[model samples]
Target chain A: MKEFELIRKYFSERGPKRKDVVLGVGDDAALTRVPQDKLLVVATDTMVENTHFFPDASPRSIGHRCLAVNLSDFAAMGAEPAWASVAITLPTSDEKWVEEFSNGLFEVAEYFNVQIIGGDTTQGPLTVTVCLKGFVPENKALIRSGAKSGDWIYVTGSLGDSALTVASKLNKINVKAEHLEQAQRKFNYPVARLAAGQVLRHAATSAIDISDGLIQDLSHILNASNVSAEIDVANLPISQAVLDSLDEDSAIEMALIGGEDYELLFTVPEEQKGYLEQNATAMGVPFTCIGQVRGGDSGICLVKSGQKYPLPNLNGYQHFSSEEN
Target chain B: MKEFELIRKYFSERGPKRKDVVLGVGDDAALTRVPQDKLLVVATDTMVENTHFFPDASPRSIGHRCLAVNLSDFAAMGAEPAWASVAITLPTSDEKWVEEFSNGLFEVAEYFNVQIIGGDTTQGPLTVTVCLKGFVPENKALIRSGAKSGDWIYVTGSLGDSALTVASKLNKINVKAEHLEQAQRKFNYPVARLAAGQVLRHAATSAIDISDGLIQDLSHILNASNVSAEIDVANLPISQAVLDSLDEDSAIEMALIGGEDYELLFTVPEEQKGYLEQNATAMGVPFTCIGQVRGGDSGICLVKSGQKYPLPNLNGYQHFSSEEN
Candidate 1:
């Protein structure tokens, strides 16, 4: 079978039925009606082999991660994800790989209440691109330009474990079996903090998803909002699994500079801090106040103990880094 | 710099200013407010290296083709394209490639009056995925399933030239240089029939863009509309350039099975055919009647010398054909 026929036969099976979708795949274009009271929030993310994932990574994990990362984008914007279009390119049309990949993708999508509305499948080196279409009330989305001076910065969940898992997988680092599994799962199935984001809309002045390391990703909000931040090094959230596998210093470094955590990071005004703490407690999710937004300087700073120290030069994952070569 | 920083520095430049674009790139997700009175149409297409284009094709052409194909999908639906998001994956972050690609993408976007709303960039083998969001009046859009028996099938411009261009390029066939240039241009930069599609909304009963060759793509309408078609083989609009490059039989075959023409193939009611022809002529484009829809075996057939015959087994372009190996 040719590529189009293969797609029509195998990949063009019935997607999740939804009232929002007027038309699905196999047509010239998909048609969906957005509710009148909602604004559409759109985000796209692409993952490549060897750079975003190991060549040996299962197709199921790749598919899951592809949708997961796009969902993270929706989470950052405080949007309720509704529909997604996926474009998959492969070195060849390996039926086994495509079957597993689609299964994994649909599995994750089902949990998030998202449906595969449309997509394209083609031949090329393995790549997955997902464009998520979500909805939020008009003028209620969290943006990266709203942070103000005196707001408290918060991060949901722990960070840096995903980066450590990458290193362990690549450098063959030995660690406790339980720690390894937790790290691997964190790397593969990082949850998007959609509930926290939606809840924080009224409180968060600015928000961003932690795809890059905390320091680098937080810099995006600072640059966009024209504010500086002072993070308490002692308050950085490091998971027990990561802390057990690596020394305290290493865990701190990873927590500060590791990327791909997919956690929600935001700044809430001082008046809203109480509301946030209560909400986090009700949800049973950790929301640590790790930093404070400040005027002037316009960058991130780390305060260790009573002394302020300049951070080391550590750029997060560049696509063409010499270290990778 | 990391992939995120590079994207912010280069690809995050402002897009065309549009009132509909509530938020653009540089944010976690782009928020757009669709006009309350209009319906949104979404389409996505992915182009892969060596599959969608020549290995040596410039990044500019790749970007242009990527957006153009998605726009063609919008054209088929008679939708007014408003915004697009592009997800690009590259093996390495070459600054020159990014510059050219963005330039080519925005050039077409400007021509079509669409805004580059948002997208993602990552490290991977070269692949470009574009998702377009367009709008039309509620329940006033054209679709493939609206064709009825007795509708006259029509196509815009000529066909079969793109396939010939591909063959010529691959085999290094030395035909007339002008003919080859015309053919190659049609293959690379075929225009989507946006104007024709929009104007024909009232006249066209069913429509589709000819990306998968005329016979095969038209089969989609037949299958969806539950009708058969009788196409006069002699009436196919074959350009002189394409005719000169091959014998009459081969030219007919090319027109029937050649893909990537990107022209509009549509059906009009008998009463509206005259209006369509007059409108097309006023627009300075050719609209040729090639067939008539009928209720029969629900398949396409060809009429040669007043005798009906089943078309040959020349399927349209399939991406995963074993013959490629």
Candidate 2:
């Protein structure tokens, strides 16, 4: 398909027009009106073959993951996604792939009420980069530097299922049929905790999305907040699917250090703990208290049976690390 | 180097925190405060190796062009660039290439006062995509649908030199040393007409950046505006360097349909022509009156000596075109 025709058929037809989007895709640049009292949150994420995804990964999964990861950033900032642009580089212009990819992208975009504003298509290896623009009230954004020493650390939803799915795919590991599908689905369409983030904005002091493993990513929040954390391994949110497929120790380790979960990890003040628990229940999202923020040299630790144990130096998803999968 | 170390050494160190940027890179995401009265202009462009640029092109030039093309999108919207995020995919972590690329990116970014805020890096075939976010007064953005019949069409700077430079590079066409350098520079670092765009936002009825050659890209504006245009071939702006290097016929054809000249092509009211001309002169940017918008006729024509000639039917830079460079 020609570039213009491909764009019109797939992307241009998918997004809903909004009043704030004065102009959208098919223009040289998209025009969006930002309300005077709001701050704009912008973030970009790129997925590449053999790096962010498997070479043979489904196009739908790729598109879903690309936008989902970016939305995770918005969740981190306590912002609502308003508009997004996708720049896709492909080895070839395959109509079926484009159709599926656009469907995947628009599925999530429509859910978030985000307009597909602008994009570029080019010839190259398959890579998808999406820039998401969101809006938040002034001074309402959650930042990594706002956590206090006495804040309680928490994570929404379960973790490690995506990592387990990756392992199963790579080794062709045969697990219980239902558990296998559940793990794979979690890997393919990890949801960004946008609702939880919106509620936590009022109570959380610091926030981050788990793209890297929980331990490493939470370390970023700790380091930025200038505090240390002690996460109870038993309290870590491990999915039943992960637990069914592996031993408790291995499942807990994966939950702590496995990447691509796309859940939000945040810190709430001690005084607001009750309010947070109540609000989270009202929101219908599970929240687990895993640790407490403490002042000192900043690092993460694991607590077991009321005894503190130093965590291993194994950093999560360092890109260059030679750690075995 | 590790991914985190590489990110800190290059991207994190270059962009200083600005007032408008409430939060910058190094966190989970960047947060910025946008003026309430302004419309936010957003654009994304991707450059791929052996596709957008030559495989052997300098990393600095690659970086510069990557950012420059996105800036051109902002220029098309008549917006002042405020912030940008870059997502790069590389085959491997080459420190030297990353250094030069980051340097080139920062040079133009600093010049334009655009802060580099957040981005993602991954492993893949070499690709760079930059998402530019800018601010413009609400209702002041230049749109492609604003042109009307009888409007005067104007372009900033000469066209086709960049295409000629690409030809020269590929064929090793040895022109005058100065001409070769000028052509190469044009191909490498075509400046986005940001200031002219800002000034023309009110004056120009419609606007677009000439990326896919003049004839093809102008068709987009015409299609969007529901108008056609008539060009005076004799008055086409061909730089002396391009004319000196190629025959007049080839030069005219290149100027008409060659792509990658990051110049502004816009339409203004007939009454505002003199004002635009004077403003261009004051800004030290060239203003060439080459055409006039007309009723939609489904085609562009060239008028020479009061005789109309049908323009050649070369669709600009079609990826599937059999003419493989």
**Every model's TM-score on chain B:** 0.93, 0.95
| Deviating ranges (above 4 Å) for candidate 1 | A1-15, A281-284, A320-325, B1-10, B281-284, B315-317, B321-325
Worst 10 residues of 2 chain B by lDDT: B316-325
**Predicted candidate 1 versus true structure: per-residue lDDT over A1-325, tens digit per residue:** 4565666654566446678777777678877888998888899888888878989998889888999988888888888998888888887778788778887787888888787877888777888888889799988999999999999999999987788898788774556888889888989877778888888887799888888778877887898899999999888888877788888777788888788888888999999988887787543467889989999855888887867856756743433421100
Residue B263 alpha-carbon offset, candidate 2, angstroms: 1.2
**lDDT, candidate 1, B1-325, per-residue tens:** 4665666666566447788888887788898988887877888888887877888887777777788888888878888998888887777778888888877787778789888887877666788888898788887788899899999999989998788888887884455898988887777776778888787887998888888789888988898899999999899998677799888878888888888888888999999977886787543467789989998655998998899755756633443521100
Q: What is the DockQ of each candidate?
A: 0.51, 0.49
The TM-score between candidate 2 and the true structure equals 0.95
Q: Against the true chain A, what TM-score does chain A of candidate 2 give? A: 0.95
Per-residue error at A121 for model 2, in Å? Answer: 1.2
Q: Give the CAPRI rating of model 1.
A: medium
- Residues B218-284, candidate 2: write the lDDT tens digits: 8888988888999998888887777888887777887888788888899999888877867865434
| lDDT, candidate 2, A214-241, per-residue tens | 8888878887778898888888889888
DockQ, model 1, C-alpha based: 0.51
